[model samples]
Target: MLKMELFGESLKQIGCFQFSGVPCSYLAPMINYAINTNSFIMSNNEGDAVAIASGISLANYKKSFGVVLMQNSGLSNALSPLTSLNYTFEIPILGFVSLRGERDDMGNNTDEPQHELLGIITDKLLRTCDIAYDFLDSDFNEAEQQLQVAYDYLAKGKSYFFIVKNNTFEKCALNHDKNIFFEKKINTLQVKDSNSNFLPKRIEVLQHLSYFSKMNEIALFATTGKTGRELYEVEDLDNQLYMVGSMGCVSSLALGVTLQTSKKVIAIDGDSALLMRLGALSTNAYYASLHNKGNFCHILLDNESHDSTGGQFNLSPNVNFAEVAYFCGYEKVFIISSFEELEQALCFFKNRNTGGAILIYVKILKGSKEKLGRPKVTPKQVASRMANFLSKD
Candidate 1:
């Protein structure tokens, strides 16, 4: 088997230093190597890992690469962002998916029964997602060549994956010791039930947030759906990335951007989108504290309905988002329903300097202005410009 250093060093030579993913036994060696030598964000799930990698790739301006590692079963968890976020945005990431039930020379399946079906369909699934992949070579020199080929594809803004079999890399010990502890504080501002309907509309909140972004010179990631479309209508700036299809990934992607840049990064999220991946809140909070990213702001526009999909009622009303954020490890949490509270919250965020991410849960009504329009700027252009914006000193 090739030493893990050979693979890791080769990836470094090819400009890939950022890595994230869920744990897999076959991938443990490479994961250990990355943990010891590079920046690896152990994501809460595979999809978030892909989206975080996308954020790193986008912010790096193609000068560096992000790698994703997961088991074949977890590939299903990664499929959404891999297709919707990476493919749609042309964000390239090097993915290594472990082959759990690979066939041997005699063509017999050689893995656990649990992996049978997924193993049978893994390659087909990759093809269906339009991801080109190669079997990781057992030879060190050949694998180094494979890394260069992967870089070639990544340079073209196309993701290249590697299907890794068992024992592909020599065992490597995790030498890094990491410790992160943050107090969970729940701070809430009570709003009267009578004032619920009178709360700010989604567009008004966007207008305020858009203004705050412009005034602070921050990068904003608007979640998929009306939040992004509305932000596009509010103001389409080079520093704003309007997520088109990767629902529930805005915060995790913002976390990636926060790790890559010192600029304040704000993510505008929706109730439905946040619910799609509730685990992201915990992931974002954890990394924010671990990395000491005080500039990350997670704003959830809770309307209790999916306004973009005909205003269907959702479960947001039953849940206390501020408490969730608090328990999830956000250093600061604010619940605001009116413009006055929002303004105060923004001022506090701007003035504050040291803490983890700040979560602003804004309760709003579920309605948009008549004839709301989508962004005229293409997703690739958005990604490119945001990369350039982040690259600036």
Candidate 2:
């Protein structure tokens, strides 16, 4: 068995500090160490972990890095962002995925029934994702060599994985609380005039929000579909990234970027996309509450329909997004239906420097401009420029 310190000290030696992901038994020792050192962000799920880690990688490149941990079963949850976000953007992250079900000498599965299929196919899945991997070594020098190889891959902007077998690390006790909690005075605002029949269109809100991209103090992220396309049409700036895929990961990516840099991150998300990864709301609030240097603003454009894919109705009309965010631990919540209220919310974000997660639920109308064109730049180009902008001191 390998002492956790042998691996942990090597990671620190290579300038990797940020860690995020869900818990896995095989990774508990490392997770406990990360939590004890106050360097880990507990993610809601595997996909969010990948997106969050990608954000950290993008913010500063090789100078800093993030490691994502998960069980092999969680690979299904992580597949989306691993392929769409990380692969498309060419972002690198080191990961530990535990092997729960492995065949013995007689070729018999040794884990529960649920892990059977995934374990049998884990190697193939990683290969399909274009991720290279190596089995973690138990010896000190061998483990250090493996980590250096992983770091070499990361330095070239390529992701690498360690397939952790059972009992890879010696047992380590957790001295810190695993539960995430933050007690702060949260501000709630309901900005519906009740008499005004005016509801902002998607473009109108995007136009107003594009002003933030004009300045470098804020890093703007537009969600997939019409939201990103509309923002691209308004203006593509060095401070903004138009998310092409990974439908619901924009907010989690924003959280990752927020944690890495002092620049405030604003995620302009759609109702459908937000609903796809609802658990991220709590994760954002939880991390923001603890990491006081980072500020994350989540703006949900509730148009009640999927304007990009089709005019199908979504669940947003039935959901109270602002109240849900408040209950989920957002430091501030704003429910607005008119442009005036949106203006007020923007001012609130601009003037306040208090670090925590903030939510703005804006009611918007559907439909886009005639023949709205897609972004001219590729996703890699967009990610590269944003990374450059964030890296500037």
Candidate 3:
């Protein structure tokens, strides 16, 4: 039997302890072990895991390799960030992928019809993503050899993968009954008095954020599309991180940043963007409650349309964001549809978030200024700047 603790210890010895992933039956015991005894995060999905890993790795730059573990069936989910975010930015991650239906000695020939095709093409997919891979063995010595290969690739600013057979990790059962606790708190949400013209456009909100960030020691993470472009226009301060491509991941990235920094981390998001990664709302809320130091804030701009994507309809007209944040466990929820409300909410969270995590819903107009430009810098540049800023404090 492979000792899960030994492998985890080896990973720590080499300074690669940040682990994030979804659970798979093949690696349940290992995941359980991680939950019990490591700085592990239950990333909402495979791709979220990749992004969170990237954030953690970037936070611990020069001293960490973010490890992502998932099943072969979910590799497709991870392909986006693995290629665009991690590979493009030269972020390294050691992946442990379960071979759900391999044809070799560890093959599950009769496992499931769905796992068969995914297993057959797992290595092909990895190769297509320009990721190098090696199969994992039960022996710790063999695993260390594979880790050495991954470490070598990481040293050169690249990613690597490990394909593992089922049952490679010994059983580590979850005692969820004793380890779990849930408490639902009922609190009324507050709204500020503000003007509701929706005239200034989302750009105005970005401008407000720019001014606010300049005055306060804050870290700002913008969502993809116009929100990012508009923030770029406002001014790309070292503290401002514009998420260019990942639509719904801004909050997740901000959450990861909050875990590493004491700065007031805020995710400036859009309506469509928030809808795309609704799970992030819950994830951030959960973590904020656990780490309830008021280190995180979520500012969502609801224009009622996907203005960045040709103004497509995003969500129902009646969706109450304040209620969503309230139920999601935000320490304070503000439903601000006007400039006054927006300003007041900003002031409330400015000096200190005495209440807890905050969500500010800013309803704005649909159109932006003519000839709005994109980020002049590359993603790696933006990521590196943000990473460097976060590392300092």
Best by TM-score: 2
TM-score of each: 0.94, 0.96, 0.91
Q: What is the C-alpha lDDT of each candidate?
A: 0.85, 0.85, 0.78
- Indicate the residue-level lDDT of 1 in model 3: 59
> lDDT by residue for model 2 over 289-311, one digit each (tens)?
78865367899888799889877
How far does residue 299 in candidate 3 sit from its true spot (Å)?
Answer: 1.3
The residue pairs that clash in candidate 2, if any, are none
Q: What C-alpha lDDT, on a 0 to 100 scale, does residue 306 get in candidate 1? A: 83
TM-score of 2: 0.96
**Can you give the lDDT of residue 377 in candidate 3?**
88
Give candidate 2's whole-model lDDT. 0.85
Residues 179-239 of candidate 1: C-alpha lDDT, one tens digit per residue:
3345544344343344454478888888988898888888999999888898889878888
lDDT of 3 at 354: 36
Which candidate do you rate higher for TM-score, 2 or 3? 2
Candidate 2, run of 10 with poorest lDDT: 185-194
| RMSD, candidate 2, Å | 1.7
lDDT of 1 at 188: 44
Error of 3 at 322 (Å): 2.5
Candidate that beats the other on TM-score, 1 or 3, i.e. the better one:
1
